[model samples]
Target chain A: MTNKTEKKGFSRRQFLKASGAASAVAGGAGLGLFGYEAGKDPRTYRGWENWEGVNQVFNRKKYAVDQPTCQKVGPTRRVDARTEVIFYRRGSFMRQWREETGLEGMEPHIQEYYRKNPEDLELDIYSQEVIFPKLMEDRKKYQDQFRLSDAWSNAMGAVSPPRITEPPEVSDFPRRSRRGGSTEPVKFKDPKKTSKLIKKIAHELGSTLVGIAKLNPDWVYKYTSIGRGFQSDEPIEVPKHWQNAIVVGTPMSWDPMYANPNYGTSNDAYSRSRIIAFRVASFIKQLGYAARPHTPGTDYDLMVPPILVDAGIGEQSRPSIVVTPELGLNFRPAIITTNLPLHPDKPISFGVQDFCDHCKICAENCPSDAISYGDRVEVRGYLRWQVNTAKCLNFWNSTLGSMGCRLCVAVCPYTRKSNWIHKAALKVTADDPTGISEKALTMMQKRFYPGPEPQKYYIPSLGGENASYREPPWWLRTEDFIE
Target chain B: MQFFISGWFWFLEGILTCLMVVGLKFYMEDKGIPMPFWKWILFGLWILLAGFTIAFVGTSLGEGEPTAAKLGGILFGLTSTISGIALWRILLTGRNKT
Candidate 1:
């Protein structure tokens, strides 16, 4: 054995030389991966020229001029007032049960699971035992700190209901005398041009995406209970004269959205949308027309998702939320019902349904198994994948000191940053009308970015020190607008 | 500090580890020693797995104060020490036999 080993012995000096050569090769490979070009300023890499010239070669915009409009596969039906998730939660029976038994109407299995695995109940206990109690004890202060946007939205709730009377006439406004006035409604001469202008204004007022649809009566709720709690059983009727609807979306920042089950981060998108919707409604009103904005924390007669679909904004994904080409499910939609004559957009189909069919990441990662992995089914007249709302709400109420769950938004493949690599993939997926590329794309996504692991939220920066709910940034709070 | 939490740090670490393993293999070959290629590969994989296991267990058992970076650093240190001991054994075995 010694003789055989001696024959294969290597000198230290020779080994050192070989190691140096290998190091050089490795260094070269590392540099190659960066794809750095000589004499090019990296800071100027994102200039318009790069986007229009070089980037366009790889990322052809996926929109087609003559793509067929998407069709609703089933007949439309009004959502039953009793069946609505929020209404059911607010019902006296459920509220009384929640107060009597601290279970929040959770299933037996979920409570049992928590009881069986006490160690895994850390978050649940911390939320229920500590955070929620403190928040409730000082409700006003906590509301200001944690739910500033919600409070503001609630304050603006009076505007959400249709006004009983028109505003008092301004002296300077061009108008006929009231006694023998020309009562003819003002005609918008150019519908297409006016629609474009409205969209531009909405975008300027902080809407991420803006689309118009001829108001579908089926999308309107037959009756809606206003405000929190079941104080009055009176149902508000939606007026039929509001013939057009403007759907607007605003995106939540990724940092907060990624920190799911957390209150401030998860609800920031909703708050931002509320602010935008209010401003857009005001703008529309100034154009000599009636505009009623439906915002978060306010009574709403319209179902937002179906309206968004009809407006050509996005398609509903597996989690029963609209996923747009630009932002996936990381945005909130608000509606402005108006009688303004505007050209409505056709419903768009960019292969989102096919991609969602193949990619069940959201369903798999859902803590409550609330998201469905099955095919679309007709529900209340719309053919779509529906989530188990009871399971989802129960999970939300039981964890993380917050009444929300954004796990679906956090894990969506399309919720990636708009970098070059993602843009390329998106372009390809959008162009593949037949959805033949979905399986390969899904595989690539999994390989590149693995699913979230257990106890993944234990990082100190994400949870302990900087874990306090994030306040809205100055830009979000300030009223200043750039021209 | 942000780099540690960001995904890029892991990518860089993976590239560095691969390079280190390649260099070690080349060094053994140049020394005229018939490389125990399978043994080296197994050792590398074992170290990686052990490091990951330590991080997972440490974070799981810890009160919510340990960041991913802190746990990752602990894993790196522990794995590096083990790898050094392993390499020493290999060198000693090779030299003494010769």
Candidate 2:
């Protein structure tokens, strides 16, 4: 056995030398040395330099392309399905302004009043909070009367059985062609006529929110690394056919989602992104114009932040998430870079930068501490809060098995549902004219959506398929983008 | 030489060990009081142990003399000891609690 004194004692000089040596070894080996290499990412914060070589080991970088290009447009149409458009009525009692003692007088008698009038009840149900408990009671009574629990059975007092919308066919897949093929950019007979139609088409394609923005050169990545269609530079002189870009966001199902923030809980986000991209791409191609979808799974050509900013979707927040009015940060974005020539939505100034200045909720709840509570700094042309991708990626690698983490998206305040009441306040706060409006909105959001408290870490699971808490599979590589 | 030089060995070793620890920890943390200190110690020990285990298991099952068998022995002993200690700590902790 070694002598205890010699073996156990660690000198400051020895520690320093060891640390320096370790960092040097890590940096040379392509590991970020505890995120020391975050400096390499133009959009990242310096504080993220903690996890040295983690970024190299776990990130799915093999998919990275040296220069990313759009896929070839093929012949396909979008499959449409009649689906329930869930309109959520947030529990009014849960709102901050109201105190709930469950008292008789406090129970909004307005529900009982509407129950008497069918015409009034339908109107009230659209805008006002539906009496969920009453509905539950009525459902129970009906079930007991008919002695039926089958959702498809109308035998119960239930007037109509629950029905799913008809799903679209596989033929609806979007057409693809190699970038700049024989397809002349679909010409719009009139620019004014096209923009309005494009906006309307975007909504039908399952985009909860859509905005048109002029494509800026800065928004395009300095270089592309992954995905289909290869272009080295901005195609020299831009094609006159392509002009405006459409930014779209698909919201996640809040019920299955609010339960956890682990990667498994985030499967819904990816699935939604795929669905929206597939549908939106098909819709654009059907219009006989060129439209390319940018999804995390599909591309490295364009940056989402710039597209989102130009489209006026939401203000960038401190946790480095896009904060939209309706979904907060809970949405996964899909971009359709097109030449349809549409009216551009001006980026709005929602004191989001200032709100994020004071709000560190995501940072507080981040189990990996990937988020920074630090002030925003200049990156390229814009000033924004940047996370340590190395740290974030490392945590994702550890917790999510293969998918990586979406807890930042899960816990953001902007991710709240856009209820009627919330919409009213959002409309007022969207402009954020004076800094005062932003301050008020932040206060209101803080009051309504109290930030998560720090507690022991809990690993949220996605039930069976992705239950193994293993690192990602070998295929999905984020490291291919690192170099 | 190529294996270690390429860093694939270390990378694979680190990843395997990390996965094992994190996977076990995920299941274990939910069961009872978190044995934080013991877990930390076990975490360090397993890296050394698992690394050698991979090297050793490869050799013993294979047809040739293990060129890295000396280092392989060290890895095996370290892994065995660490796993034993980790199990021992867990058992002892559980026993004391009971």
Candidate 3:
């Protein structure tokens, strides 16, 4: 035998010496008996087989206003307008700060970024301190390599609606004119029927998830932004007619989204989301109901996660993005406000909070270390794992293209793609009364799916190859485009 | 290390070690070889380690981490089984009269 290493390491006699000893212990515990059968799985939610956590509507029957699940999330608090992070160009926190502090008072190096993008939510002191300096340094250090990264991101396609301040005309389906009280509004005698129709319309319009929730004024931004943009100095109030909200969510394209910070644009899913919102809002308006679509990135008036929770879309996970059992963290949303009188869906629970508590893969894989490693904290009266956005945005802009990162989104165990096998695993994980399967599954993710170190995604010295979850698909092929 | 698991090299190693350990026991018993008390305990540990490695391998295959996790457990499991067998053999040759 040419395999001397094996031959010399263990002779036939040596093998005989060991197996005899092993039989005693191996015989005691037979290997064939300790597995599970999907058919006989004890995990059923309300007798729903293999659909334990499949739907996004976790808002259980007889929904609790204060506590969605057995877990006490604490007293719910409305987001204060004064402290809310406003990303609209006119109402941006940086815009307010610049108006008050003046650009002359700003650091000269970072003044360029704000001047170029005043409404950018990430344009803050952290960008000035950590991100801009790195940008300037990378600009000089890896000129063509940096350009290549930008080209690769651009080749995947630019995130649409480049400017946050784009007028409502971005939606081609605008209402004919401002609605008046002079005409009797078209009434849906049965709100439940109308809601069902709206949901069907949303799906037909390409929504992956849709739900009706009464507008929670607490989630609405109070100060810098308004229900609509272009309002000047006067503090604004939500119009009385802005009552029921229709939240439409779209899943991000699978291959590109799984790539995360490397080739993925965090905003890609939102483009589709916003389109669905525009269509749904237009449908409501044509039916003679007052409707206003809050475009995802460009024109939303409120923080999204809480409203998503209220709408029964999903529960917010550790990264603070709402994770539905259907799409996990892969959903992007657009909200339409109207007085359409739809039956409101209550908040849901399907063990997302519980799954998040045990599965720290997102926290462990975060490139920016932006995701919280600690337990959920009560912020503004709601319980959540608060992401340090400063750390997150800094890592995002530090990358060459300034394409935002979704490393958290990509790594989240809940973000599993829907398939029969994954669905079975998810159901087991969701309804495992013993929690044994969840623990084992979490262990599998932690052990088998190791990703590269954080710096590999952005650090020019490292060449960023290991950054993607898998290689870019054929269209995003680097060699075909770059070389 | 990664390749060993990815290629299922460790599973081969673990299974071979387990067979070798168990095979040696029957051989000794067939020849009426008088192993000492401490050697018997050492022999039991070899089987125990191999049994656990096989259990992890079984669980990994069931849990849908078929390649790296399953093969990796088997690979490292071989190391533990080999060590137990080696220690058991050393105990058999030891000067101590237990």
Candidate 4:
């Protein structure tokens, strides 16, 4: 019976009524939206304030850890299956680099490889097209990116040892306990407390994260890469004193990380991480425990990711490295093998498996199309998203200025810096109870953070110029600030 | 009260609401399009959604999440708000039998 014009007028009473209803609906939805995850995390997760009080805002659930992709659960290979020592870098063209100090030709190593495997064609194409041209071009003109990349490496290399060996800092000369001056190793009545102390000490020594895992011979490498062009030929065995392996991690600098697929970020994180490894190893030695640090550049006798997963460092992602809930893809791990009594942490899951299934931002943005857009494939004894490391490295060599391409790392939604809004969005997406949020979140990620043409990152001759995820920092590239 | 306070709801919401109001006014008053009552509600809701997008952009920017994401979001939110206003103008022009 209400007149049409009166209805169109929107009376004051009707406006107030609609406004009250909207306020009530919005309030109720907010209470429900936020109230769901409250009081769930009984433990007060410390520091890195963004993750603090996160539960009150976002629904984050830390589920039980899953088995790492590298771990061949329920052993299939015997101790002496194929004695010629599996070189982890066998496929990587890095093995072909001319010298211990990189940025050189791989002509001789590539010829030797063809002699060994007549069927190997991937590296053949890579060398002919990418590496040879890069080295030839390197002589003519040195780009600003390569110069910046070399500067970062040289800075780190200033402190780097020639080969992988125990740092002098990890000596047992002061083995006598400060409390008792006892020559005997300090004894722990409870392994749990020792584990806690180890973590506390590692954190105090500037470790971003610390975890312990039992030594798995399966994760140990047959031969250790001591330095470029030098790897131990004799079988590197996990020593008897090395019963527990401590995995410590630190996040990469976000400033440089924003401009990844460039030289500024990766080694910067590793330099800090490798030092943390030595410090933790030294602390164990001071406790009269034998320990060995396997650092980032050339010191590892173990597969870092599998051991990191074994120690509950993080869950494996589509890109194959472990991603932590706290740091996401912006993390690097350093391991220390020791005889110290420490509790092992179980593998953890933070919903990466499901999230990566739907989100292909990394694969889509990879410059050389190296990251797989296909479904997870079973390779070796485990399943993972297989990437052409040769193509990836070739892109690294061909990138206008740098020798490393972290395009995949830079574009990943998980590789975000720790902030409150990201915290909430990531938490909901990780919990992903409805399954709808994952798809919705991925859609939003693509829309808001849309990638440039992947080809834009290639060399000029290769049909693209160096368009980056974000511009490199001003200090590194002199042109940015120069008059 | 505790949720809104520690959770930074008011700070985020209060800023975003002001942005939404400004965004809606920026578009709606351009040609002085006479809004129908229901169209006003739809226009308001669309502007509110765009505010959410802006809030998301600012939060992400502070976190080193991608520069492209921030720029795209600002572009998309402001453009979409104008499109929302234009949508209503088209409908009002459609009622041209007078």
Q: DockQ: which candidate is best? A: 3
Among all candidates shown, the one with the greatest lDDT: 3
Model 1 Cα shift for residue A381 (angstroms): 1.7
Worst 10 residues of 2 chain A by lDDT: A79-88
Instruction: Please provide the root mean square deviation of candidate 4 (C-alpha atoms, Å).
Output: 9.5
| Model 1 ranges with Cα > 4 A deviation | A1-71, A91-186, A227-237, A401-403, A454-483, B1-98
TM-score order, best first, reads 4, 3, 1, 2
Error of 2 at B1 (Å): 73
What is the CA-based DockQ of model 1? 0.05
**Clashing pairs for predicted structure model 1, backbone only:** A10-B31
In the range A70-97, model 2's lDDT, one tens digit per residue, is: 1113432211100000111122213311
Model 1 chain B, TM?
A: 0.49
Task: Answer with 1 or 4, whichever has the higher TM-score.
Answer: 4
DockQ scores of the candidates? 0.05, 0.02, 0.15, 0.08
Q: What TM-score does structure 2 among the candidates reach?
A: 0.44
What TM value does model 4 have? 0.70
Error of 3 at A119 (Å): 21
* Winner by DockQ between candidate 3 and candidate 1: 3
Deviating ranges (above 4 Å) for candidate 3: A1-83, A86-123, A136-184, A225-227, A230-234, A461-466, B1-98
